[model samples]
Target: MKKPLKFPDFKDEDKAADWLDKTDFSDHLEPSDLKKINLPNLKSTKRLISLRVEESLVEKAKQKAVKLHIPYQTLMRQVLHRGLEAI
Candidate 1:
């Protein structure tokens, strides 16, 4: 197994930025060391269309979206995308 990356505790944002500024990410992210992670809310280069659904359903989704800290539309898209992939 590869060693986990260790980062130092910074005094503030500037110190953290300074360290990151000098560091070479290639040294850390070699192709063999790379791992895939799902990036939620990644904006797609696509046009939007008008989509209509039941208001009650939208309200319920909005309530859940608020707890997850994402817009209802983004949450819906994520759910729909996953559903599509499951087929």
Candidate 2:
């Protein structure tokens, strides 16, 4: 039987972060790791379109993105894609 993996427990957030920073796994990743990962391709080949939203809407989108810990542009793209699919 294989022994269960045991992970070290850190007492504090700083200790945990420091442990992660000190650990090196360069050998585990290949050249492909250095390349940008592409998202699953959407069949739509339509040209990109830009839309102007109200200042308040933009601020709200930014705030939501920040709260969710994601880039505002990424959140906007997700919202747009879902909206298009719904229509």
Output the number of the lDDT-best candidate.
Answer: 1
lDDT of 2 by residue, 1-87 (tens): 232323366555445545667766454455454546333332344457788899999999999999999999878877986699799
Report clashes for each candidate as comma-separated counts.
Answer: 0, 0
Q: Give the lDDT of residue 52 in candidate 2.
A: 87
lDDT of each: 0.72, 0.66
For the record, the alpha-carbon RMSD of candidate 2 to the native fold, in angstroms, is: 14.2
Model 1 residue 55 lDDT score: 97
- Scored by lDDT, model 2 comes in at 0.66
TM-score of each: 0.49, 0.44
Tens-digit lDDT track for model 1 on 16-84?
Answer: 655778787764565677667543433444458888899998999999999999999878876886699
